[model samples]
Target chain A: MKKLWNIFKAGLVTDNPLLILMIGLCSALAVTSTVSNGIGMGLAMTFVLLFSEIFVSTFRKAIPSSVRMPIFLIIIGGFTTIVDLVLKAYFPELSKSMGVFIPLIVVNCIIMGRVEAFSYKQKLVDSIFDALGMGLGYTWVLVGMSAFREVLGNGTFLGVQVMPQSYQPILFFILPPGGFLIFGLFIAFNIWMKNRMALKAEAAAAKENA
Target chain B: MKGNARLGLILAVFAAIGCGTLAVVQGITAPAIAMQSEKALNESLKKLFPEAASFEDITETLKSTSKTVSFEKAYLVKSAAAPLGVAVKAVGSSYGGAAKLLVGVGLTRNIAGVTVLELADTAGLGQNAMNDAYYVNKAEKITFPGQFKGKYLTDAFEVKKDVVAITAATISSKALTEIVKTAADAAAAWLENQAAPVATPADQAAAAASGAPAQAGAAPTGGK
Candidate 1:
């Protein structure tokens, strides 16, 4: 149980796909304009991540080293297509709004990174935990960025008017530059938090030694 | 040699699995996707011409007459005995890739409105062309699709000079304007051809005589 907790914790904070590792920043920044968009994108990516990890770990032995990358791509591509088709069928509005980004998930490095770095060496259960933690971690940050942007840029949350009447929305928050500006701040915060935690840990270890 | 052969076999197996999964999912969803697109096109056409009671596909009319610019499809919009005008689906090259639009040309040979169907331009700049809500309070500057309403083809659709280009997205704005111009020209040419075939010879002669100024006025190069 403790071992499984460690695997999950590593993905959530120590090795987050977006904040710490920065594996899939390109696709991540594209859909952070609204909390709904963030949730949709994050969930879609998580679905792909979870399934790809499972497939990669299951076939780790059968997939020869020379052909592993191609195999990973195949698995990821298949899952992404399924998600794309499902979205188009059931959530046509979202599918339309998201455009080509849904299919582009096949190329997201976060999924490939997990398959190679963690899933390839780990068992299926541990890989599932890692995928969940990383996926949720990425999701919460995306949601945060989106909530900030949507409220400030559009003066709404999930299309509902939330801001006071006199407050003018800043158009810049929902634009591309806004995405980069917010992403940079989130990265800085993550780094600062990590540094503070590391210092605290070091001081505790020294006190124990003394 | 044996190891290489095994790798090949494994890769083939993986490819087969991927293909099989895609085929199954596509088979289940293809019909739904088609229906959704059809519904969306109908909805967009309706929105573009709110007054039109119905629309008839006249893409064939444009294809048979115009050769310089081609549209994806053209629709003849109508309400009872009145001709609402024609709407054409045109594509233009944006900074990203293609910006697709449904352009409505009214009976008076002026632009009625433009609705962006698909835009894949940069998120902030080119996308401003489609973000009409962004221009609601900031109407002092550029207004998209709204600024296009009621402008005649004689305007020649020049960016910045006639239509205020979206800030930082001149390429995208230019592309969209060109697309509108192309649709307008094709529509005007088709309307001219439709009017020409029905005129009697005496009327044709009279049209040639007095229509000279009208022809000059409606010329595709009127304002370039």
Candidate 2:
């Protein structure tokens, strides 16, 4: 359980797929214009990530080392297709709104990276925890970025008018350039926070030794 | 050799499982997805022509008769007695990509309403065209597709001239206007041909000869 906790912590902060590792930057940037879109995409990614991790780990032994990548792709692609179809059938409006990004989840580097790096080597429970942490980490960053964009860019929170009527929305925050700029700032903040935590831990350890 | 053969078999088994899973999920969701889209289209049509008691899909007939403009589908809306209006589903190239909409033309050759079905325009700028609140606030006085409502079919319908373009979303606004114009012109043409069907060879010859003048008076030829 402690080992599983470590795995989960590692994914959330120490080795975040978006911030630290930066595996799935494309979809992250493209869908971060609104909170709902960000959350929707994050949930979709989580669903795909969690299921693919399980499938990869479950079949780790049977999968040939030589053709393992291809097998992993098959599993990931299958799960993505399921999510895509389910979204289309049930939430048709969201399916239209997300557009091509749902299908593009098949190529998101985070899913492939997790399957290759952790799931292939880790046990099932640890893999699931790692996936949950990484997925949530990715989700929170997306939500944060989208909240900033949606509020500043549109003067609204989740499409509700929050600012005064006089507030003229700065359109820059919701554009493609704004997505990149916000993403870079988020990454820098993540790195700074990690360093600060590390320094604090070292200081505590040094004082204890003294 | 034996180890290589074993790897191939394992890979094949995994592929089979993946394909089987996809097939099952697809089989279950395919019909539902189709129904959803159909329902959405019907709802949009209903919104555009609310008073109409029934809607008859004249997409194939419109396609066959429409000489120049290409529309996805055209529905002939009607009450109990006479034809009420026509709703044409059109797709146009916007800044992002394709933007699809439904334009309703009443029997009097005026726009009843314009409903944007699917738009992939940029988030803040072009997307404002699809925003309901942006067009609904009567205080602001600026509206998106609502500007096109009640517009006569013969009007040039030029963006920034006849209709106000969405701020910073001129491309998307222009694209939607062009699409609506195309649909309106096609519906007008269909109405004209319906009034005077080309049954005889002389009438066909006259239609072919007067096509240029008819297009000019009826539908503006160039993309505004």
Query: What pairs collide in candidate 1?
Result: none
Off by over 4 Å in 1: A161-178, A195-210, B51-70, B78-83, B122-126, B136-143, B164-171, B196-224
Q: Provide backbone clash counts, one per model.
A: 0, 0
For model 2, what is the alpha-carbon lDDT of residue A99?
Answer: 77
Where does model 1 sit among the CAPRI classes?
Answer: medium
List runs of model 2 lying over 4 Å from the truth.
A207-210, B1-9, B64-70, B136-142, B196-224
- List each candidate's DockQ score: 0.58, 0.82
Q: Is the docking of candidate 2 incorrect, acceptable, medium or high quality?
A: high
- Model 1 whole-model lDDT (C-alpha atoms): 0.80
List TM-scores for all candidates, in order.
Answer: 0.82, 0.88
TM-score for candidate 1: 0.82
In candidate 2, position B208 carries an lDDT of 45
Tens-digit lDDT track of model 1 for A17-69? 89899989988788888788899999999999999998888878787887888
Best by lDDT: 2
